[model samples]
Target: MVTATADFVVPDELLAHEPPEARGVPRDAVRMLVSTPSAQRHQLFRDLPTVLRPGDLLVVNTSATLPAAVPTLDGHVIHFSTCRADGTWLVEPRLAGRAGAPTVGPLDTAVAGQRFALRGGGSVTLLSPYSQGRLWVAALSFDDVPGYLSRHGSPIRYSYVPRSWPLSAYQTVFATEPGSAEMPSAGRPFTDRIVTRLVSAGVQVAPIVLHTGVASAEGHERPYPEWFSVPASTARAVASAQRVIAVGTTVVRALETTGGAAGSGWTDLVVTPERGVRVVDGLLTGFHEPHASHLDLLAAVAGPGLVSTSYAAALAAGYRWHEFGDVNLLLSEHDVREV
Candidate 1:
């Protein structure tokens, strides 16, 4: 309903179809554009570990990408989350069709716990089903969303990242959450080694879960609406840490959600300038397009000109867009001057 378009237009060549041949030496090895409430600075992604000090806590979304969308036979698409799978899973089912009168639908050709029987003997199964047809609230499990996607499903895909990639490639080095369709791409370059180094360097690390649906692009230009929750430990870490650096927009939303006046709930909180930000001190994220709701959240916290200027720099410098590309790291002016 809140349909809109990005203010800036990305050149066809700027879109990244895949990551570098190998994950970079430092997951954060890519170039980083540093923005703050005060001024602008340019740096590399690897410089991130050093940019912030020991007391600065890095908050990462441990939410895993969920491979919940699968095609059905009768035109009824079954969308579900994979909980567990030994070739079987509890899945949330959705009849992705006209939200009205149903003709035969895809039910006739749909099988609950078995593969749809592709052209060959190959098959995919919606192993588990929810209490009803509620995909969002369903407690569905599958052998493995990751495993199945490797075999049949695509990267909890969307038009943004524009190409099918192995699920492993889609994940961030610190990925532990198994419910995101797409990896928190901003964190994609943060490989295990980088994370280890950050830990050794005294940068505190904490996890929050946010099961991201697909990319925000598919949701009619709406803000990324994800299922997120902060653990007590994470909550505590955030409250006590001298600095909180969100790994990506998703983590930002999750962390900010917990800090809100209402506290926490099943948040469909679409962060915007009006809603404003509370907990995040700095952010490491992909360069979102102009007018993106995520950008609004950025503006809410980082200021409109700040994000806009940083984005312009990112674009001018030929920084890649989407997951599988370079990154932008923003620190608060208050911290920038201190460092």
Candidate 2:
């Protein structure tokens, strides 16, 4: 595992608290910081058609966000993270009132075998610690999980966002398959119009499925295995494209897991400078928090020198951060040596 060391403090004011739509900004109009080893340029996300070459393939994740936060009767929120192959779930329990409060961590008192009644009719019994003591393997008593969430769950939110938003706000234009605990937010800035423009400009777009689990923002933990699938068509595109630009780190994980070949299954692959990227040529992703594991993936694709330079430029230019914030497009430079 590669440890990220992109140390830099983000001013609290730069954290986007709501979607661009709420701020009267069109999704495709959000600012994008385009960076390469040699230079950086500020542009709008809608200018993607001009940034990418005609034969370049843009890989996007189509995993839809789930309203994964379900409130319990005793005032706790259960964030259903991932469904194990055995039909159980990995969950994180947070005290309801304090859950969304900034800088507060999830409840750590949940012991194995403890049960909590859901607001509806079912109960979740904590089975064991899933990872790092932050998430638990839970046995859910409810059936038709999707229906239950549609009725009782809201989008999993944090304190940075002051109000609840509709699930639509958490989805991207490419979203179709529903399973991700949180949005693969890097794709959130895309719009149908922008996609049309990309196609008109001859840039190719392909879809992959990678259902992301709950984020490890607070803990900065390494990502766990998540389900992903690369279709035969996309794999063929990747093999032939002049460049392969992954729309999000999720796509990078999926494509790299299969080494550009078509396949599907759980992947624990973590792209780092040591394991450098093999198929992806560039990355179009949202600005991540300081020291995020996502930064390691960026370094793997573009090298640490370019990643650091790009982030410094973004911060100096007051670019926003987080899922709802602005984006960064990091292109590989053949002349720049990886650190």
Candidate 3:
């Protein structure tokens, strides 16, 4: 197993409190830190088309965000993580604050068969422990999960964001399938204009589907297995591309799991510096927490040295952090040739 330690401290000020659109900044106008083997450069996200070669393939996730957080009568919030093949769900229960923000709740005291009443006339019974007791295997009383969520659920909110935002704010232009618990945030910055420019510049863009689960705010927790699908056309595009640039860690996980093949299933593959990567040549992702596991994937693609240097630059430049923050484009020197 590959593990990562927290290498630096992220100041509280760097956290983005709201989306750029709320602050009068266009989504595509957000700052971008471009890191290559030779140098690091500061640019706007709108300049993405100029940063890549014509034949470079940009792989993006097409999973849309779901309003997965439902409030319980006991003042706890249930975050629906993922659905199992057997039809049960993996969920995390968090304490709801007075202002409606959520914090990590006690999972140790939760017992199997314990049931919590939902606000909208349903209940969830805890079936077993999942992910080493960090989450629970839950069986919802409602038969239509999506329909129930649409009527009673809101987008999951953490303490950083003081108020709730609409579901539209959590979606990307490429979203076609609805299943992800959270947004594939790296693609959040891409607008119709930028995609048009990229296509006009001959940068091929393809879609992969990866339904992301709820993010673990705890320390050093490895990512759980999530659902993904790589279509035949995307696989072919990846195999023949001059370079494959993944738009997020989710895309990297999907592509690396399939190794440029067309397939669909759950992926538990975690990209680490030791394991490295085979299908991805570059990555465009949002800034992560100092100790986030996503950093390991970035290091695997671009090397630890480049990842460290680029992060330091981003910190020094006062770049924002989190889903609604600035972005980093890491162009790796070690392409598929090394594989």
lDDT string, candidate 3, 161-253, tens digits: 877899989999999998998999999999999999999989999999999999876666766779999999999999889999999999999
Model 2, 1-339: lDDT tens digits are 333336788898888999999999999999998888678988899888988877889999999999998888888788989877778888898867655443245888889999999987988999998776679989999867777888888898887787778999999999999999999999999989999989998899999999988888653575677989999999999999989999999999999999999999989998888999999999999888776788888999988888888888988999988889999999975442221
**TM-score for each of the candidates:** 0.73, 0.94, 0.94
- Per residue, candidate 1 scores C-alpha lDDT tens digits across 256-320 of 77782223334567667677678888788887765556776677667677777787777788888
In TM-score terms, candidate 2 sits at 0.94
Worst lDDT run of 10 residues, candidate 2, spans: 330-339
lDDT of each: 0.62, 0.87, 0.86
- Cα lDDT of model 2 overall? 0.87
Worst 10 residues of 3 by lDDT: 330-339
Off by over 4 Å in 1: 1-6, 22-26, 68-151, 158-163, 218-225, 260-265, 334-339
For model 3 the local lDDT of residue 64 reads 93
